[model samples]
Target: MSLLNEYRIRLAQEQDLRAALEMKLQAWREAYSSFRDEGFFAHHESQLDQQLAWWERGLAGGAQFWIAETGDGKIVGLAGGTPTIEEDQDTGVDIELGVLYVLKEYYGTGLAAHLMDTVLSRRDALLWVLEGNARAINFYTKHGFVPDGTSEELVGSWAGLREQRMVRKHG
Candidate 1:
């Protein structure tokens, strides 16, 4: 069977946490290594256990998280969002697309779009993307998202990177 045909998207379960974490780490390394300082990843690596715990806790709390898994049950992509009331008040957006990531090897395979479509489901939502990530910006744009002229410099250990907000209206 084709690789695309072998994968399925479903709501993430507790057992999928480790694979989701691994996919997040891998996607970051592949997508951000060129522009992000080593310290950024170092911080993320140091927080792996904490992130895992957070994932478990969030899952237990009934948060929305989904994963694309292969026939062998290996997760290759993940997407998640949460309800937000104040962040996009001016635009009337109620959901925040917190994350949408796919393994590097899965790029150009329609998996990211699939994950995004599944999460947003044509709802009005907002998300922030690192300013220089052209690939992500393009992907979001292709999916009907447009920049709303909002930008913010990241703080803490990732102080130098800038993030831009993008919004996809209900259609």
Candidate 2:
């Protein structure tokens, strides 16, 4: 039996935010451990409440979010999409996939893809990914997203890393 069979993906509710955020943090820690130290995660950990509040507001405002959980209700993956906030975006992409993360233990189980499809479907969308995260970049590329040549320097605890934008357009 496959691990994917043990999971279900559905729209996230208010109660799921904390677990989803913690799972996201774990994913980040696993993915960036090579270049980032404990301080980086510690800074993010200190801001969990702020992040939770932001998610609450976004959810209240109708931002779409999805989570992948086990039968026992352990959240292992999450994805969210919202209207693009880039005022100068020229591609006319209206949706921004702001988050898509899965626990490292489930890396090849297709849970991430299920969460992504649940949130994004076939919409024309854009997402910003850490520049050196080849796994994420490749996954997005496989899902029809391609870099649009836009990049930005991150600040604060993320100072050394950069973000690159990728987009998928539907005709």
Per-residue lDDT of 48-87 in model 2, one digit per residue for the tens? Answer: 9999999999889887688888999999888888778865
TM-score of 2: 0.93
Model 2, runs deviating above 4 Å: none
Which whole-number lDDT from 0 to 100 does residue 31 have in model 1? Answer: 94
Candidate 1 per-residue C-alpha lDDT over 62-121 given as tens digits, one digit per residue, 9 for 90 to 100: 897989999888889999998865756776788889999999888988999889889988
lDDT of each: 0.88, 0.88
User: Each prediction's TM-score against the native?
Assistant: 0.93, 0.93
Off by over 4 Å in 1: none
Error of 1 at 119 (Å): 0.7
Poorest stretch of ten by lDDT in candidate 1: 83-92
**lDDT of model 2 at position 122:** 86
Our tally of clashes for model 2 stands at 0
